[model samples]
Target chain A: MKPQSMGQAVLIGLALIYLASLYFMSSPVWMGFTINALIVAVVALAWNITGGFGGMASFGHAAMYGTGAYASAILQVQYGINPWIAFGAGIVAGAAMGAFIGALAFRYGLKGSYFALVTLAFAEVLRICASSFAITGGGSGLQLRLEPGLSTLQFNDRSVVYTILLVIVALVMALTAWLKYSRFGAYLIAVRENEDAARALGIDTYRIKVKAMAISGAFAGLAGVLYLQVWLFIDSAVVYGSAISIEALIGPIIGGAGTVWGPLIGTLGLHLLGEGAKHLLHNAPGLNFVLYAVVLICALRFLPQGLMGLAARIGTFRKKEDDNA
Target chain B: MLEVRNLSKSFGGLKAVSDASLDVPEGGIVGLLGPNGAGKTTCFTMIAGFTRPNEGTVRFMGQDVTGLPPHRICALGMIRTFQIVQPFAGLTVQENIAVGAYLHHHDRTEAMAVARQVGKRLGMGAMLDRPASSLTIAGRKRLELARALATGAKLLLLDEVMAGLIPSEVSEIVGIIRQIRDEGHTFLMIEHVMQAVMSLAETAYVLNHGKMIAHGTPKELVQDPAVVEAYLGHGAAARLQEGHHA
Candidate 1:
């Protein structure tokens, strides 16, 4: 695939530099907020793998996120496994869940809005089951022990955890960058454009989509694990709710889905917008959502292809002008 | 290189195709001619493994490949281009061809090189960087052929590759097809353009009412009475024969 190119190197370097800069922020509170946004950003990146690249817009990404969170939490609190090991296991469990759901959905040839609805149902079913199960601590959920250390994956210094999270997100961004020009990436895009055409071109589109969903699940699961390590607790409503799923897709949609940098950029941009709304309308908390709706409407209206598309349009414009000159 | 035997397909008892058969010898250009709704595309779908036949077998390169999926059939060196010209609209012309090239060349660079070579061979050198969506109908048709060719498949089943084109464009495609045939690829094409078929096809099969009505040289099929009645109507074949006599 020629993945480890200068572009990927530059991307990872930029990510590390951005994380180093974030460490210098004066307020710890803002750092925590940034960490939360980073976790959501990870989920958005996960969404980009399938939703953007593969054109499988999942409305139930929370199924993977919540599955990861609950799996790790259950392993630590119940089985008494090492938190770090449980974190790895949680990511695997989430990926397996993603693969399982993807196989079933794609097997039945569910696509478009039908595929989205099927995934939504899977997440809803998982939420109900997680709430009912005793191992998950029912509606109250599970909490890890108060022990805080690198071994436990919990950090006394928020910066340590933030750096780790950013590093993981950066690795995923690198992988996404690889997907930009790789053969698999081409297959994914071909499947997205037209599955029949892709098949005729000798691409196993069903397999590619399942793999994309699994990769997306791994990252979404990692995002969940990050949340658990930060909070030391997880509940069905908090983790498996529609809110996380909605948050996961919103970033990619705004920043540009199916691009190397769109998901992360979109997530960060949304959080900044949310913070601005909070400051501007301090008295009315919910009014910010109304403003978000307005911005989202405008974004959809003007930039239908998202931020990366805007960049691409400008790039082609310049290339054309150069040709003219 | 390609053979179909008694292929039958019924879309809920409508009998889209029944007992239709044709064969293309190695390195030959064969045409499948039928009017609209004559089940020509259905026959292509059956051979390309997009649809299974009710009763029949498809032998490509002397191997039975019936009921297989399209991708597997493509990997076996047989690929079909859609009649509607299915291009990955968001991708550039080169990228679109590269998607097919990936079948033979796994490396992106290697595939892109093959895509460029095949695209330019089909006279699409200047359009390589252009987006597939921007191409006109003729460009898209050439793109369709280029993509199938890019797969490095030995046999191509083209469904209406020149359905909508100016006379000059049609002639250009006919020349391209003839050149490709001489380069050792076999072809089974469904074409409504009579001039291109007569000029390019060594043998042509006629389908009417989901049945094979005739199989002969394009000139011979043009004179057959049943084929004339089912396809070209009464006066058209007489006019063609008089032109031949003259």
Candidate 2:
């Protein structure tokens, strides 16, 4: 493999190894937190498709996540659908929602901050609708039965859920790697770099971005369904809240916006920092968030390219040292 | 082959281009010579699908492609380069050209091969791995040409690719363009540098104040009074008749 592929393989291998080790940990609460962090990582990876690679940063990604959650929840609670079928349906719903919002925004030429704001509005609108609509259980949320079996995709042991998310993160990571070498990824990045140049080169940037959004939405939606299954409950705020949107964007930004392993690594680091803060502060109410904000500000200010950029810089430095030797 | 008929564009109260027409035959070098605001770039934009002309038609290879988007025009075997080169800052020079090469060759490896070949042909072979943002102005100009050629477009509307280059660098580009022209690609170049355009273009059209004032060979345009007046002051055409050079 080329050095580029070598870097990607090493990064992905390390991420997979860390994720697999989570299954062996016996602590229930730690396992729960790990699973939640990994789940958020998936959505962050999804966000990276358009927000990172395509440079169409979204601030309301919870639209697709909430859409998937509500779709699956409504199916099981109201229509007597199987959990597995609802899972498939929910991902499709998320992709559809992605396409809907992407088409609406791109067709109107909304880009940069405008695109971000539109997506946020879409999520907020979905949250309001999910809360007010009767089909979505209105103010009350839907809950899955406490069945501990593979059939329902829920388990008494948290390890099963952790393993499932591992496969998902691994697959998405591989997909991100594929994009690193794919023609579509080149055009998408070109669009991100210079839309006019991309268009002049015969790239239909509109189609590429919409497809990226659909793919992104599918994973984010998958994360939402996964969240619903593990907790056995999902309400408007739990699924469609702006907090999820913020989380989806934050992990990728902190890790490395456009790299394959940036989202996972960033999410893990942030999760640990957050948990460590909670422990040191005696689980204080909002103090952890205060520290989180400070760290985020610092990350943005000093490490604009995030942790992956630092790693790349160090890698080059070591290579230079070796060349000297 | 590209032809523009009575093309005009106005930005609210300002007439950027008015009733301007140009024709480029196959495998020929055509020049659009004008002053700073002669609407040369505007005409290029309208022909290449970046802007819609308020009046007139653009026919490419016998098809009416007046208001088609740039990508569509590109697929129909025509491309344009900007006056200000916009390379993908995050990508390497190879990857930057590969974006254009991917138009015909869908396979990534195949596209990369085409990009490499085009880079080699354009004399930027050694810098393919370098990030596009690292290029000098002349390098960027070559990159713009390399990318446009990599797309396999038969006709190129270059909007001043040699705008910001040194004389030696401009000569290098003029040689590359001549080589490409020999390879059977049509060129409609908007050039402010008369020396390069005079040596390169067989046919020339001069636009003054958004209107075509003269159409002839480079030799004929140098002597045309209207064209001379467009460049120099008014009576300079009469002075040129008496063998007085500026």
Candidate 3:
């Protein structure tokens, strides 16, 4: 990784110290939940690259996510492989799958809503495949035994999972920050704005788009690995559900699309909203989804550019004020 | 230097360019003057490699570049600006120019240098930092010229560049075009501004109904019977004749 910027170093140091405090001060359960949020944040941030910057909005991120979950689960359950190795393998598998789908969609000249439909269809296909595949435990699912060891990627202590998740989030955030200033990032933006123009400038827009999708899928896959490690179980419903894909998009949209900080804000807001809904409408099982829809609708209408855009505007406004002062 | 031979493009049954041929030598502005629906734009597009001619060859610097993509053709030192100016709206004027410069240099600093130089050349130095969408029509035209210039193109394909400019602006643009030519750049311009064409173009090609009606020096071109009949009405040519006699 490139040397962290002063701000990034400070932020990462604070995050690390915060994680250290989780071991010394916070309850293990609290750490576990916080880590869960971070994992979701990482996945959402990755998703924003393809859906937001690349302008190829997808609703099948869960397919990759679920693939990771199941790949790791089955590797541990059946092949007797180390969970760490399984995690890496799962990420690769997810990226490959993402590239496959991206190529197929692009090759068939699908774009916009049709692209979204293709992704949605892939999710459903994966879900159905998982349900019918007996080797994957089908509907019965696979649960890992919680062994207390670093090598196993399973621990009796919830704090370990929390720390792991914190590290993953930090890594994902750093990767995204690196990409923002890189040539690939600029090319992706160019491809998004105008494909023909990008092509005219000697950019292979197709390759950039596919690379973005693959990276996003790989991140989602990593998130799935952690999720499976944390919960100790991977069911077809949990891995391949369309809801997981929707959950992935909500954080990025709420945070801001295209900007690094947007997904974090989005994930935090969505999590808070979900928590509030759970507390306020605990008896009504369907109210959480309704609340999610409401928040998304409100976000789309009011904060169309997301909180990051609002923050950037405020930053520029303040900067101007400072200049005048 | 460029040569187009037997270039033909038909859209369905409508012949856009019919066996058109032109050879442009280095270091001169060759004006492509034609009435509306004369397929002047089609010929330009074919030469710029935007569209493939149904049956023809485009030799740029003596290489057959007929069916190559637009960007590859651009990379080989040929660039075109649209008749309708398309300023990348979200980008600043400097950034838009920088994209053109990026074809030659990847270093942002070097691209900025080229952008600054080209911007100053086109009288757009003050507006470089402004967003292109916010520019005036005249400013947009300058941006288009700056962008094309920044591409390091040896030959420029300009289509209707003076369509919206006032007479003063047109004259200024003509001066710039001539100055660029003096600096060793070749130009193929499609223009309806006859006075500018008459002053700036050493050679002129007139098209009518997708056929090459006349090709000669501007002096001979304006005097051609078919050219006068095509541009001026048959009666208007007579009026000119009577006015000259009087």
Interface RMSD of each candidate, angstroms, one decimal: 3.7, 4.5, 5.3
Ten contiguous residues with the weakest lDDT in model 2 chain A: A316-325
Provide the DockQ value for model 1: 0.59
Q: Of the pair 1 and 3, which is ahead by lDDT?
A: 1
Better of 1 and 2 by DockQ: 2
Residues A144-201, candidate 2: write the lDDT tens digits: 8788787887888677788888888889889987987899899889999999989999
lDDT by residue (tens digit), candidate 1, A177-280: 78768899999999999999999999888899999999999988888888998988899988898888988888888878887677876787777788877887
DockQ of each: 0.59, 0.62, 0.29
Candidates sorted by lDDT, best first: 2, 1, 3
Tens-digit lDDT string for candidate 3 (A52-72): 778888988888888888888
Q: Residue A142 deviation, candidate 1, in Å?
A: 1.0
Name the better of 2 and 3 by DockQ. 2
User: Which candidate, 2 or 3, would have the higher lDDT against the true structure?
Assistant: 2
Sorted on DockQ, best first, the list reads 2, 1, 3
Candidate 3 residues B1-246, lDDT tens each? 899898899999999999999988899899998899999999988887778899989999989999887778888998887888877665678877776787777777787788888998888887887767788788888888887788798998888999989999888888989888999999999999888899989998999888898999999998888889888766777778889999
Local accuracy by lDDT, each model: 0.87, 0.88, 0.80
- Supply candidate 1's per-residue lDDT for B58: 95
Model 2 per-residue lDDT tens digits across residues B197-218: 9999999999988999999999
